[model samples]
Target: MTAVTKRFGQFTAVDNLSLDVPEGQIIGFLGPNGAGKSTSLRMGLGIMEPDSGSVELFGRAPNVQSLRRVGFLPEERGLYKKMTARDTISHFARLKGLSASDARARADELLEATELGEFSRSRISKLSKGMAQKVQILSTLAHRPDFLILDEPFSGLDPVNQQALENLIRAEHDRGATILFSTHVMEHAERLCDRIVMMARGRKVLDGTLKEAFASLGQGARISVEHGFDLAAALSPKGFEAIRTADVGHGETWRIELPPGREAQDALRAALEAGAPITGFAPEEARLRDVFVSLVGEADAAALEASLAEDGVA
Candidate 1:
């Protein structure tokens, strides 16, 4: 999509967003709920028309021939409740242009690989929510399309299933399939994506590799000291910038921003030399959530945190 925009009545859901999914790369579309991620994705697939700008799929307009090479799993999931799991997968594969025999074979292969072989003959309504979700995912890839687009694919799954899906994505990539998956969960993106695109309130905020994202925020360390101790005041004269972050039961934690030439060891040395009663310390690892916070500020960061908690991640 190039400078695509979408509006819903008086509201603009996606504003001048441009994105690229390079072949053979795993791209993560990241943002909290209501961040325009779903809208942007719908526009990309030509499911919804953009109010402005343009979209191209497979180097051409999103036509039938080009769409045949793609597989998509929408955020809202539904399966034919009366259909057997195996039949469901085979049906979708057939829709994607596979022969009946090949589709059935692909369904069996996917069922066994996902440990759902015993449930192959079971109807969708007879399966658990998670099991039905797995069936839908398998249906998305049963035809072995060249490109895959999954939106918020991990929301209903437990930790084990989420990890399994990540492995599945990796395996598909190794098979020469390009993937674009959207998620509010930062950890998933951090683990799987070659590059990330973040959105906030309908606008694209950041687009880059993990290294570039972290480098933008520089480096830092977290130090915990006795509750009454003033680590920030003590480190101030030493030219270190420290801010109190949280309160542990026996101590308080302060985040120290390291200067360009400074290191976490230097911060530790400075605290010790200042006669500070330290209880705990560690180099602060940069997280995708932190990058989002830095770009969109505290209010939106709170929303991101809420979204994570809703997904049982926080």
Candidate 2:
């Protein structure tokens, strides 16, 4: 996408967003609700047109012809309630130009692979939310499109199913498919993404490889102690910001920002000199959530974290 923008009435749903999805890489499109993730994806797939700028799929603008090589799963869940799982998947495969027998065979294979074999004959209404989601995903992959665009594929799944989806995504990547998945859950992106593009308030906030994004947060260290100490007198005087202090089990933990000249050992040495009962000490690797909070602010990050917690999508 190059300077693609979208609007609904007076509200700009997507700001001037330009994104490049490298071939064969698993890219994470990340942001909170109303951050324009879905809108940007829709524009990329040509399901919705941008008010300005251009979107290229494969090489040309996305259309029926170009989209034949793409697979998409929208965030919204919808299936024919009266249709059996296998038939629902086969139907979509046929629509994508597969023969009837080929579609049915592919559906059967995918159903078994995703652990939905026993429910192949079950109607959509009879399956659990996770099972139904599996069916929808199978339908999307039945034709084995070269590119995949998944919007919140991990939503509503328990930990086990979410792991299963992660494995499936890896399998697809191994098969040479270019995948872009959108999510508010930071952990998923941290584990599965080769690179990430983050958005906030309808505009692109950050985009880089996982290592590059981590490096952008600078350096830091954490120390977990069994007793209290005067952090202000020790580190604050040395130009370190005490990022957080938390109670853990029978002890407490402190995360301190390290200045450019300092390191983790330097922080540990300072804590030891202060006579704190240190239990654990280590360098603080940058987390996706930390990067997100820094770029988007704490309020939006907290709101998104709360939304994920409510959905049990940790």
Q: Assess the local accuracy of residue 84 in candidate 2 as a C-alpha lDDT between 0 and 100.
A: 99
lDDT of 1: 0.93
Candidate 2: C-alpha lDDT: 0.87
For each candidate, give its TM-score against the true structure: 0.84, 0.84
lDDT of 1 by residue, 178-211 (tens): 9999999988999999999999989999999887
**Model 1: per-residue Cα lDDT at residue 279:** 95
- Off-target runs (Cα >4 Å) in candidate 2 are 222-280
Q: Which portions of model 1 show Cα errors greater than 4 Å?
A: 222-256, 259-281
Q: Give the alpha carbon lDDT tens digit for every residue of 1-314 in model 2.
A: 99998999999989999999999999999988778999999999988999998999988988887788888999998999999999999999998989999999999999999888999999999999999998998898889989999999999998999999999999999999999999989789999999999988899989998877776676788787774555645677657776547887777778888775577788888777777678888797778888888887777887778767777765
Q: What does candidate 2 score in Cα RMSD to the true structure?
A: 4.3
